[model samples]
Target: MTARALQRMIHVGCRELGLDADTRRDLQLVATGKASMAEMSEAELAKLLEALKARGFKPGFKPGVEPGAKGRRPAAPRPDLRYIHVLWGLLGKAGALKKPGRDGLNAFLRTRFEGKWGSVPIDIDALRDAGQINDVTRALKDMCRRAGVDT
Candidate 1:
């Protein structure tokens, strides 16, 4: 793979593992070609994933795992997404933003999202940097369905 492609892959992998802020920032630098992914050792990557697993952030296939003709189909309709319906709907209303607006989303998130997670959000740029906006959209739809939202 091209170095750029590999860097992108590494970026996605790091995010999937719920990396801490500093590590995620460093990886993002590498991903954007400002730094080098080769600087990190394979051992470091393995250890990071181990820690993620311990935190209940196990990485698996896309949420929907379909069977062949004889078995049950995958439950998810849009398995490629990230985040969830609330974010999806909120962000959708603010489409085509190059970066999330400073005030708009924050206000909604603070109010509507407060008690749901019992905390504020972390860097939203993490999701934007994934470069899979459509997949994230699809994933949110599937999430809504799975959550029994009458989708």
Candidate 2:
């Protein structure tokens, strides 16, 4: 995971634990090897998480798990048509795609999923019927990350 993601997890854990500033600082020092949580290596971040968990600070969600979707089971590992639509909307809002229609989406997909583009239709209905939704979802997420917008 990225350092920023690790830091976010740590902050969320601290908040849930109701840790005071001083205690938080000490934990940060122990976990990150610095007073601040900035620029921590992956190993250090793992250490920090372990320390916090040992201190009874259970994070609301595990690392790599997206937040929200309360009271529902975690989403399936495979991407479905509905998930593709959700990702499409998110990418559009993030300004990663130029326009909002099939043409614009297809253009974006062409750049990322070159090999699969010829088979995948631009029309959402056609794409769904083709059963290439998983590939599209994966490409959309990759594009979002490359565009520096969290998926």
The prediction achieving the highest lDDT against the true structure is 2
Candidate 2 lDDT by residue in tens digits, 76-150: 344565576677777788777778655676666666565755554554544543446666777778877887867
Task: Give the runs in model 1 whose Cα sits over 4 Å from its true position.
Answer: 1-10, 17-37, 63-151
Model 2, total clashes: 0
Query: Global lDDT for candidate 1?
Result: 0.46
* CA lDDT, candidate 2, residue 92: 80
Structural similarity to truth (TM-score) of each candidate: 0.25, 0.38
User: For model 2, which pairs clash?
Assistant: none
Q: What's the residue-level lDDT of 101 in candidate 1?
A: 42
RMSD of each: 19.1, 13.4
- lDDT for position 128 in model 1: 41
How many clashes does each candidate structure show, in the order listed? 1, 0
Off by over 4 Å in 2: 61-151
lDDT at position 61, candidate 1: 40
Candidate achieving the largest TM-score = 2
